[model samples]
Target: MMPVQVVGLGLDGAQGLSPVLQSLVASAKLLVGSDRHLAYFPDHPAERLSLSDFHSALAAIVRAAEAGVSPIVVLTSGDPLFFGFGRVLLSHLSPEQVAFHPQVSSMQLAFSRIKVPWQDARLVSVHGRSLEALTQALQQGAEKLAVLTDPTNSPGAIARLLTSLDLPWQYDLWVAESLGGEDERVQQWPLAAAQQTTFAPLNVVILLRQTQAPVLPTALPLLGIPDVYFASFADRPGLMTKREVRVLALGELALPADTIWDVGAGTGSVAIEMARLGPASQIYAIEKTAAGVALIEDNARRFATPQVRAIAGRAPEALEGLPDPDRVFIGGSGGQLQPILSVCRDRLRPGGRVVLALATLEHLAEVSAWSREQGWHQRCLQVQLARSTAIASLTRFTPLNPITLVTLTRSEPSPL
Candidate 1:
């Protein structure tokens, strides 16, 4: 039987190739690999074959073995088991027919240079996958990521994606290019600056989650922090609902790990906070002002809630093309409370929850009457917050703005 050895060349350096691996490469009757790997065995008389297609390469290896070749060598990069070509070849060829020789991976070298432990980090190859998947992971606030990048999905592309998401935190990126080569270079920069760079074709992208990770929590808190804790834009200033009021509204909304719509979302404080509660859930902060949209993005990054998306147009108009929400929160309706509620009632999933926060009793009456007309159960709460502030070198009590909370739960009619 022909001896087939799968050799891993760690970053193409002399130290990365073992003596045994070197001997195998020297004795092989046929060498199958990329041009760079073939260059390693310049003295070997074996027929140098380039692997551009998997089927063609496999055919060449099998043909050499049938022709009385005692040994065949297939070259790969890094550890054969770690996102290398060995896995694919092994599936096509019997395990008993092949032997693997691994080397330290470039990923390991890159992480080592940065002095960060990577045993727990998530490693992904963007070689042939959609960049959208990376976006999804980023939205979930993936702390440690090692992205294997090509020229198409380079560090610049990643920076653009993060910038478009409007996440507030800065990323400390390490770009390691031409690793193990004499010309290898490793550079660190902020995400914005990284976007402006043009890295070598071969490189890895490392993101160090900064200290300012969003305030968003990974798990849902039974009672969330008050809305006052979130940073909001000055345009809608005090228009945001208080933390106590939001908790009551969220309770009635019964949020699920599906999708949500925060209509008239001022600064997107609630939307971002909701995303933090459930990483899998998608929160759309629908607001009309440019400043409000920017605020939502800032809050999402500040809280580490990447799942919150800010829509910069007005409701009814902005609501178009958004995923149907499992639950809806209407924070400020601008006198269109009834119309917005009417639209949301029809759009909401069956048995879904809708919570409305209003400052005036008149809007509460309007929403309550509308809910009753729709055969839905409505609940109301008047929340007043009295906070303590510093006065004359002593603490004094001050009243926070009072809010009227209304919630409507819709249920399907049961069979008579």
Candidate 2:
């Protein structure tokens, strides 16, 4: 009777095969794998069965076994049973008809290269699966992850998806490519930088969460982040939007926005909030002041919203070179309200929304006029919020600044 074996060969190629496995392969009447794997043993006398077509390869293997072709070896990469074809082969063939020899999996080698123990990591294969697997892993707080990636679901694609999730900034990403092979590459990158990088198609990705859990547990539905959660100018406590107003503005922004721009992003409170609310959105925080820029960066990193890109130039000028936004939040105009409004109106995508957090009536009047001139639908709400404060013997209600939230949306055309 023929003895079928699935030998795992990873990146080490022929050198990784053991002497016993080598002997078995040298004696086999049939061998199967991709062309690259077969190329490793050029002198072997076995009849080659390429894996380009699963049905053809399976038929050939079965026919060989039925004809009593001794020592039939099917070569594969890494651990054959893990996200590999060995599992499928076992389901089709009897245990007595097959045996498996597993080399170090690429996932194992990836973690070894990083010198991190990964017994607890969630092993996800994006080869033929949706990215929702990754989203579920992150949302469930799996701190350590090792992903098996394919050409389509590349490391860059995975990074962008993760960044788009608006997860707290807590992971250090490592890409391990061509493990155990010549020209193997292993590098680490921040999520933002990873989104802009290109990696070899064959790679393993390891994500190590910088911390055990989010510093502030994301309150369900992602709102009501306290003003003190962000880093702001100590003397300018009022610079941030009060939690109540921030939530209202977030509601008006009608989240799950594809793209958002947070103009005058003081301490990035509103921008960060928008990011958390709409994880799939690209949120840009544009601030003109050096201190504001620094604060936005610090807060974005602190909150794990690296997706919230902070620009250091004033609006209208800074807004240049940015993508058309699905939602624009103007919190500080730097007295360029009219010009900023004009640019926002021009850059806003069709059916997009613009929200302005105005402390002054002048800015409100300018925005309302612009909405009218542009023929966009407009709505305004004045948010008056008061929080409880404690004195020696009593709790008193302290009122915060009232903000006028102006929302403008372009009208969808009537049916012809």
Candidate 3:
């Protein structure tokens, strides 16, 4: 079989082809491409085969090869292997039967125009897939993204989707249209503005996270955050879990939790942190006080974590209507530590962890007894954090109340 030569074309069209690539195209016995590509060579002597859709094009290419067509050429946009038809052709055929001449990918061009490095960025294509993948990446705290959009899933549609998810505040969007062409336009727009504006069908979207953005969406694991970063009630400045204690509790909860419950979630500090740690998971903040609920909502919004949902009402009762959790964090048990632990233990999936952070010995004794009764594995840690303060010209260490964290993991059933 003759080696099918796949040539990558940029927005510069046929004019952008190098001398070597131009000769290869001009000398082809048969050329296969879309009508737009075929239009580039009006006076060429090669027999033109215009086709749309991948399946039909593959079938046509097979027929041409069987017909003894020598020096077949396929025209594609940008780098044929960078989310292009050349990859499909190679998959249907063999590497030895195909040759690729790649141009600069649209993603590369878009990033270059914006004058930013994309080596650390996530690349995605919504050509035929759902926007959920993009949403997931954002929730996971991706700092940079380059998405290829199709006609139905235009830049405006994507913008609308982000705004609908209350994500407009986190990222800056840039739409690069018709690169390398006379009508080329590369413009940056706030996600809100992009939702209302329209762009050409052929475009790439670049999303960059804003500076000092609190939400940790990327793969860099965020363990602990200081108390100063969160909001607290006027009468309770130090009510929330300190960063040191939060980190220890998080380690016990494990990672990639499918479902998480933060019981007695005061101000949702622990809940928000859990959501950040496991962005792909769903986290529920169960709070009894109305003020606590309001604060949880505010903090979740501030972090731009849609996965953290604040539920107002007391638990083991509030936990009734919610989904079972793989990891549970009980920051305040409302003096019902035993009953709450029982409910959480019963609701936890096998191997799931339940972490309780308490300020007293009574709560600790109750949790330890419950763990032994349930035949579950348990671990205990105590955190005593103190911050240094300035008393006059000399530095003084201010002591914080000690906290105890009890971790219980539901043991797997014995083998049959």
Candidate 4:
């Protein structure tokens, strides 16, 4: 029986193929591939079979080869065995009748052009596949990654997805387009710039995570700043209030308060925002954990919130020495939700607002009961935010922890 030749072509096309592989294609009795792959051997005398249905095409090629076709060539892109059509062909054609000739894969060319080692890199393809693998790697903060792009999951779209994520780690993104071709272009792109720019349809995206701790960002928004800029606990990185929750809490606080208190301040995110909004106001950040206290102090200095004072003690006790607050934000009650509210009730000035960001239903119920018993004017805003992300060519939503921002104001005391 005649052997079936499975040849891998690179972006550079057949002109860059080895003499042996070129000769095999040049003298083929039958050839099979897509239009782009078939276009390379236009002048060849072989009977061309344009591949549409994979199984049907393979069946035809096998029949031709077994019927004494001298040479049957199947043109596929890059390393035929690696994420290529050779695997499918092997499933139907016997190993003895199929020979694989691999070229430089797009992933290999990508890392080579970016000048980064690929031995430890995670290679993923969004071509006709789900994006779960890629999403997992990104969430785990993988060091090096190479992504094969399809027309639907283009470089720009992937870049846009990356920027939208609220992950702690950061990456330097690069795109290698038309690798091994005359019009090849390689570029290191800023995530923001890449989100708006168009890249070639034939491309691979590279992500190299920054090794060093990211330098704290200097340019700050007047209200809510990105959470990545904050230095957080190494053990529990996502312990602080999220940006969406913080934004709503800040609005509820109605800033410019003469004195603002942030109870259970983990990273001082809420306290820092208060200081930013009313730079002249004194911002007190109270925390029970020493590590949290230190983070608050460091984040305070990092964000230029000099007015922020981090108290290294739990609430009810920590609230004793601080002056009466014009506004109070209880981010974490540390299981003392009621006690913290009681302390806040005693110290909060007339017309002052106390906003609590409760993540659990228990905390919400506790705070709600306390507010009603105290007969306080309350307004509650429940925020359930879902961030948009890309899973290959499809867009999916990842839900953030739901939070209820409850605003409380003291009124005439009522029956318990």
TM values, all candidates: 0.56, 0.55, 0.57, 0.68
Cα TM-score of candidate 1: 0.56
Candidate models: Cα lDDT each? 0.73, 0.80, 0.79, 0.82
Writing each residue's lDDT as its tens digit, candidate 2 over 1-416 gives 33788899977787888898888778778889988889898888778899999898987888787778878899999889999989888877888999888999999989989999999889998887766677667645576899988766778777766655434334678999888888799999877787677787679899876542245545544687765456665434346776788889888888878888999987898998888877778999999988889888988888888789999998889999998999899888899988988897778888788888999888788888887888888888998876553221234454666789988778743332
TM-score of 4: 0.68
Model 4 lDDT, residue 223, Cα: 77
Q: Over the stretch 281-390, how does candidate 3's per-residue lDDT look in tens digits?
A: 99999999998998889889877789999998888888898888888898987877778888886788876888888899878887788888888877788888775532
Model 1 Cα lDDT, one tens digit per residue, 44-65 = 7877789877688887777676
Query: In model 2, which runs have C-alpha deviations exceeding 4 angstroms?
Result: 212-416
Off by over 4 Å in 1: 12-15, 66-68, 168-170, 213-416
How much is the lDDT of residue 130 in candidate 1? 62
- Order the candidate numbers by TM-score, best to worst: 4, 3, 1, 2
Model 3 scores a C-alpha lDDT of 0.79
lDDT of 1 at 44: 72
Question: Residue 52, candidate 3: how far off, in angstroms?
Answer: 2.2
Where in model 3 is the C-alpha error above 4 Å?
A: 167-169, 214-416
Worst 10 residues of 1 by lDDT: 388-397
Query: Which candidate ranks first by TM-score, i.e. highest?
Result: 4
